[model samples]
Target: MADIRRRKFVAVLGGMTVAWPLVTRAQQPVKKIGFLSVSSPGAHAPFVAAFNEGLKEVGFLEGQNLAVEYAWAEGNFDRLATLAAGLIHNRVDVIAAMSGDVSIRAAIKASSTIPVVFISGSDPVQTGLVASLARPAMSPASA
Candidate 1:
């Protein structure tokens, strides 16, 4: 869980940095980030809180500089694809997929343009999510 939390923190920070320049240039509305998880919101509150705190530390406040759209599967792996589709339909700038490989793969399938940061217990490279742990593939959907 700690590893998951740390990955979430780093992913959000990277996403925000990538979006910052474009956001300032366009002067658009609050940037939107999509959070896709396999667990219920109630059960995943601590993980979400930790991620939010990390964002705050880097000067990005939710509802101020950014807005997050959360989708939970309630432990149902089948629902991940649907939830990921919804985030893509909403046109979120980035997606943080946490929980496991199922959620991550669902997000990967959902959008190629949106950046996806995934957390998984299994080996992502072996699963073909990336080329390797050290040098990941540069896909449009990959963060």
Candidate 2:
């Protein structure tokens, strides 16, 4: 019985491998990511620079290699929608829209196809930013 199960598993795995290329080819290309925040350009410059440094540590760089878009609201929650919409319009791969629940909601409302990562202080699930705290929907970056 074990041998039969093992054979079946191997067959399924082999079939999946054979079908992988077809699915991979249908996938889209690499995308630019957008960072939406209310921090002033100067206020967030260091953080951005730090992020670039971290990326470089892992073999990535901005402008020369990676593309990053910034949509700063300059300290106003009301402006989040406009900035988030702009990122969605740009077809950004993802939006790193860190604020509270409101900002996350704004970004999500602006676009569904493009992924959004919301960094918040409270229980993400309770705030409804995530479906559940333990097993919320996640992307590679957010995961």
TM-score of each model, paired residue for residue: 0.73, 0.67
Give lDDT tens digits, candidate 2, residues 39-109.
66788788788777877898656664467898887888889889888888888888877645666777778
Candidate 1 clashes between residue pairs 3 or more apart in a chain or in different chains:
none
Model 2 RMSD in angstroms = 12.2
Index of the highest-lDDT prediction: 1
Q: State how far residue 100 of model 2 sits from its true place (Å).
A: 3.0
Tens-place lDDT per residue, model 1, 33-69, is: 8999999999899999999998899877898878999
What lDDT, from 0 to 1, does candidate 1 have? 0.84
Residue 80 of model 2 has an lDDT of 84
TM-score of 2: 0.67
> Which candidate number maximizes TM-score?
1
